[model samples]
Target chain A: MANIAHTVHVGLGDRAYDILIGDRLLDDAGALLAERFPGRRYGIITDDNVAKAQLPRLLASLDAAGLQHSEIVLPAGESTKSWDLLGQAVEGILAARLERGDLIIALGGGVIGDLAGFASAIARRGMGFVQMPTSLLAQVDSSVGGKTGINSPHGKNLIGAFHQPKLVLADLSTLDTLSPRQFASGYAEVVKYGLIDDEAFFFWLEENQAEIFAGGPARGEAIARCCAHKARVVLEDETELGVRALLNLGHTFGHALEKDTGYSDRLLHGEGVAVGMVLAHGFSARQGLAPSQDTGRIVAHLKKAGLPTTLAEVPGTLGSTEALMAAIAQDKKVSRGALTFILTRGIGRAFIEKNVDPKAVSSFLDDMRG
Target chain B: MANIAHTVHVGLGDRAYDILIGDRLLDDAGALLAERFPGRRYGIITDDNVAKAQLPRLLASLDAAGLQHSEIVLPAGESTKSWDLLGQAVEGILAARLERGDLIIALGGGVIGDLAGFASAIARRGMGFVQMPTSLLAQVDSSVGGKTGINSPHGKNLIGAFHQPKLVLADLSTLDTLSPRQFASGYAEVVKYGLIDDEAFFFWLEENQAEIFAGGPARGEAIARCCAHKARVVLEDETELGVRALLNLGHTFGHALEKDTGYSDRLLHGEGVAVGMVLAHGFSARQGLAPSQDTGRIVAHLKKAGLPTTLAEVPGTLGSTEALMAAIAQDKKVSRGALTFILTRGIGRAFIEKNVDPKAVSSFLDDMRG
Candidate 1:
């Protein structure tokens, strides 16, 4: 394994697997997979975008190991998470005759990881999958959580399973292909790890933000820390019964904004999360639950990181407050006839608050829209 | 609670649930559901046949109990277990706006239980589900187990999940509407439990066959007994890591026969099982692993139960032995390039044989055809 920079093991009992992070882990991936998962062929699932950018490297690696492999390239976009595309992915694996013990490789960002992981979850009653997360957001967030799913017409990620991956390969080199906005979009989640119960990590990110942006060693360190933090939460609550809900700190509001913009380029998920975290802190401050200055401080850090921190910063006109409230109401995490949101007490301290008043949330959104 | 005769609790730790069996249980289901699942609306999924025969009764009861409910009526048959239908069932549940805490009721036979339960498993990352199994096959088998899914074009039940239900209401009254052939078909599974690990139960069924056919008290007793046996096996191995494989005593051969018959009504699932069980015994006796008379005895009993025990009984021109061998090789339980089957020493002495010879199996099928 060339340049094996970091290995984070998720201790999920029998379902546990390791996440490998390195500059050239992709080069050694075939050797790693051959060594760890002997005797099984591979089904490589990617999207059109990743097919052009990163597919050849992975294909070369697998071929070098003499591993049998099949490829399922879907149209690249958040929309690929629809039922039709899911069927194609599932049928693709079946057509390729991958057995239950075989592994499907999800070689892309969050959308590809979620869709491919979900297809693996149901194909042949369940198959193992490995995550080759190419996006910065995926490396630190979706890839490690075992939360594989697709968005519903009614809401985001409303249909899925909590199927863990057998392994995650975060090839740092893939980030070089990411657009500046896309890279900044992913940085929001790094900020989230620090915001949700890790003040020291937040301070570290603040000090090393420039270095991380410059692709320095701090970037790998920060991604590993984020994964490690998420791994701990997932271990405590794999099904999101409790502490794992903290991982959705900015997601509840973020998802609402995503729905408002129709899950398009106008609002990337991490960008929404960046703005959502700011709103969370702002709303908490308005309710006197968190320090007022904490919200401004979070906004400043996110702005410096090139993440959207305010509703107005989002491109295009957002939906009305009522529509945003309706979107929030439809969130999978929110129970029927009740408002539940991950509210913050201050920096590095987020908690799930059930039975939060809808009127209060609406007014906060109204104020934020200004 | 009227005429409530049997209650089997599957102790899967926190995922534990109850299987309630009783005459007129459908009448009491509304009250039972209301009392147990307060404030949770239900999305009822059933095939057109069951919807006609059982839906009105369930709806009346739910209305009586003031329970909010929605019905999704699919076409009646095995064809309903497809990707399109799975998407329809899942989207139906979502369109009905059944939240994660809400419930979906599978109100038909095995197909409905499997499809609705799978939809619940993935919808909103899993909503709680209840089984209102309306066929003898379902009441005795699928209702008790949490195995849920649809068939892949490659094989039956090749795509799905293991999401347990909140409750299983095996209302005995629903079985009255089943056709005689369908009833006898479901009886094959009842006989299977006896063959797997309960010689005494097998003997008891042999004695009470007339009573069970006449809809006497022995019918409920037999179902409850089968459920309890399955529950014990499930508790020992929920994900079929070990002991649970025993439950598929006749399934390996049965699945192949079903595939050959194109999963058509010409040879029902239980008919295939009946024939498969006879084959298992006959094959074991040929190898001197089981008493030769055991096969004769099982054939006699299944004949008396009106079940098809011989390959010749499966209507239509059969595939050649080689074709049958290929179908058997395609079994999900059989790993790549290896054969696994639930073999029997005698009645109630089935064991998993992981390395069965394909040549031997093919030759045995040739002899059985004669």
Candidate 2:
């Protein structure tokens, strides 16, 4: 039987778009985009890694569909998300002669998606853009949201805009190319949707863990499920002014850990999120909002899936608690100098807690240190 | 009797805002802002000129109203609209500890408004910003629209976003500090409203030229009338997809002249616009769209107002016609390499003309050279 695809619609009025999930979706990217943006030229932005692994497939598909395209390949890494590179990417798109009517295709992981999305957003006061996300992390998270920006020295994503893509093509087959560690890092986000507010999804993920890690039909199902949930939340609050804050389930603690690691490979974003989720659960228990058994169960699940569940599991020695606290204070979510965290009453139950006390966070960190 | 204020409300659905026009309105700035954004801190971005001449009155108002503010004063010039300075201004706002809920006040001419507005649009994924336009050019044009961006080597405003301001306070009193030459530069934009679609307003300005330039009630009335026209057009098309293009009446030729003059003091934006408007009228006659007498009348009125109305009147030699055409090609309005111009059918009868022949434009410049 042919592999069936699932379409998740992000309903944002005129800015609405669909996310197509299936194996080998890139083979159909040309047809998918041509229908929506007919006769428009394309500027494809990807990192060097993706260029080597996936560019040929995308190019062949476009060529077969009689579409014209130009490719801009930057170096592969987190460092690519900078103002200098952003300027270069924008200039590259212009150099390709892609006008406002043309489309920009982000054909790489999170970094390329962000840089290209931003370039598209500001070019001609916004041009259309499509996401051909290649990594597990991007396929499930970054590509679904319109959050596009470059990192500032002050913080990650401090300078950017909320520019949604015209369409998103998530090919699960691309996950086959990810390193085991990279794949596991993305799995962390899949686990996140369950931990956010879906008890049934969490139980399902636990039961189908092996099939998902083995890259079967279960993997695609997990990605589609996560996207559908995110799409619903985004449709309700596209700018993240209200209920969308719930989507930052492990982000507060996760961002601090990413900063502590200096945004290095020492802690991939998914890995940081995995540990952050555990810490959030632990902190909730300390505050008597959740049971200690709930925290233990979360750590056990993360460990079973080969994800780090504790700060000690991180490669480098995380300095003093004060250092982490300082990083958390600089989070984009921090408003009016108060710490805001996504705490939970139990598994699958998260809520935004604003004006959280620094002393309380400090005490919790100290206890976790043991 | 006290001068009654005029309010032009821009109807952009949820993004709607009001442009307030009055004399000595700065005295009520505190109470005005506090009511809409109560107890919110402000980050004021201005230039050295405004900081010295007008910052004191603004500071006094804020102090009297008990509002907190921090100022970032940049050197005054078009050069301040570069990426480096944009980064500095954004970083400055962050350093001031202003967050998402805080408001940024653009407290100078067009340069400050464009730079600060672009910064606020991207800072923390966008913070609210208010425009306090101090120049006639800013009050009548730039302050009304949310077109915020920085110039690139490619062309002016090639990089920007359509981020609207939350409020615009156009204090007629600020124009008192402008030099005669500076005031004339702003007068060019004032004349634009009449040329676009309001023959009655143009005739009114013609009849009251002396009083309008002499800082009388006519000046405030002219400014308010221009703002009201702009507000209505912006509400109808906030993103320049349709009628908004009508607002670029003299911009194509005006921008090319500004580029030819190196965007320097050799030709102020309004002065280039003054010449560009005449060129547009001359071009319109060349296309048989309007009578040559209309072009002559425009030149006569601009001359009476002390604004440059011909290319030869530019302070420096504007290079060859070919060079000028090159700059026009790089304009943001050029869609798919086709020239788009705002040519008039007659006074107060402007319309967008797409795919205009480059040969016709070249020949028009040749005839004007004589």
Candidate 3:
């Protein structure tokens, strides 16, 4: 009845840290943080939406622990992941009088985590940070990766650093406050872990879809399992030199969709990724790497989760296939003008395919759009 | 003569790189960089002054090596080390289409090196970079340490990342174009290497001052030795957690003087450091850590090098000892509101002194001013 928590450790020798998953983590944050960090001031960075819904609880926990803190609440949106806001967050942390030894608490979803994590990474060359991810997307993915960054006009997350968090507290209670749309958007990444490599987890998610979405024990287990998978991948390749690229399963296509929509609300990151995962499967089938049944299955699961699963389901005008290809070419993963994508052979069997032909991808996009 | 060059290897394991020092390194840069990095596009970030004097030679070298290159020339001055310029440098590098594997060549003094290095540090989570230090200050100090950053209104270098370069080319021929004042300013750091922990090096500097100023073999040897010392310190403490702080012997006091001068031409960074070194030694004498003769020897040496060794010699109005003390308090070296100073026992014997009494420092400043 203590609200059981699961711990996933990311092992990088001296830089190793743990992710704690459970319900009611906000109430326990004070004690957990104090026990882990010990006598450090906290600078809390959250988005306005999270501030309205979650900040008070987190602050109460910090106060209960007698931990002194200062908070900066940024606007809630992808646009908040800009250079100006990143500078503001860093300056705010400094103004709060946090030193190199102090810790920054990223208290919102991926935007806040990415922005705050980046600010922490570069402040005083580096500082300790804790990720209190309030969204499922962050809980299972971004918060665990240590890939903190801000968006550039040229591309998403093109400017930033790889600064890992000292701790991550994925409080399940916060997920309940998320709109069904937001929750499902994040579910795309949740399914991503399965599509990347874990067939059993994918099958488990397929069967427990109801419980997973109902905030039951399945939710916690799914999040924990996803984090564990991510941690293992990150530990093996901290700098994304090799196997880590597999983690970007839907991102190449996803980033293109997001860019096509100008990163507007009409196409949320996770929505783009949802559709992208389907496309990745579809493209894999088109490339003769997988059967069309795999693509159909992925699309079915995404649709069941109330997530966008195809180019047609995307909200805006996605322009020509050539334009989408152009956007894809701008992806950070593109190497020396060559396309690099994480294409799947089947469900839970994705592999990094480098120098994928642009013409082939463009023709596939044309087929998908048609 | 093959223009004898010396190489100092900074040992940071896989992050290790070499600093090559000699005359006319600009002529050899094409082959040197090609041999080291190989088949990578080079994005050159330089200041106007360097572009005017050294760009053609460097460009010719790249062309000779058949390497693709793009260059961004920023206005020359200390002021270029700002967040705005940092953004421009980053954007410029990206515009050049330099990817993660590409090399960014920082081809100017400290300002260019710091700005370009920082841009490389965050662009694409980091890109490869090489240092072609044209100024003497950079050749001996900033270029070797891998401490890259831009200045903030809050404080100088209060924000940045520790990004090592792949190679450093210290072209002594470029120093021939430096004004006497610039050369003397750079000599301060060279003298500092000896003052930090090498008495014999200090004695050798005293003997070879003329040769060093005249740009003889002694000049390359002195630069190479300083780089070697810095390389060792960085390898041991890449993040300034311990022994690396010793390298900031005069920086605490020097940063205050630079701030007092508003980081203008009135006090070149090295000039402030010249006077700051004297103050540090004087304060050590005041605290009975070293004999007065040690302070006198330091002042005499700086004076002989045409460097300012006293507060009265500073070109601008330094408000008050209290103001100077306040500036020192803002130093990045300040740990948790505690004053940290690198006070010396004598020439060639410096150590970290934490929580130094603020009042004691103020009175020492007052006495020095009087």
For each prediction in turn, the share of the native Cα contacts (below 8 Å between chains A and B) that it retains comes to: 0.80, 0.59, 0.54
Error of 1 at A258 (Å): 1.9
The positional error of residue B207 in candidate 2, measured at the CA in angstroms, is 1.1
Candidate 3 lDDT, A314-343, residue by residue in tens: 876778888788778878897878899999
Structural similarity to truth (TM-score) of each candidate: 0.95, 0.97, 0.98
lDDT of each: 0.90, 0.88, 0.89
Clashing pairs in 3: none
- Tens digit of lDDT per residue, candidate 3, span B137-173? 9999998878999876667788899999999988889
Residue A310 displacement (Å), model 2: 1.3
* Candidate 1 local Cα displacement, residue B253, angstroms: 2.5
List pairs with backbone clashes in candidate 2: none
List the candidate 3 regions with Cα displacement exceeding 4 Å.
Answer: A1-4, B1-4
User: How much DockQ does model 2 earn?
Assistant: 0.68
Considering just the first chain, candidate 2 attains a TM-score of 0.97
Write candidate 2's Cα lDDT for B190-256 as tens digits.
Answer: 9999999999989999999999899998998899999998888888888898899998888899888
lDDT of residue A354 for candidate 1: 85
Give the residue spans of candidate 2 off by over 4 A.
A1-4, B1-4
Clashes of each: 0, 0, 0
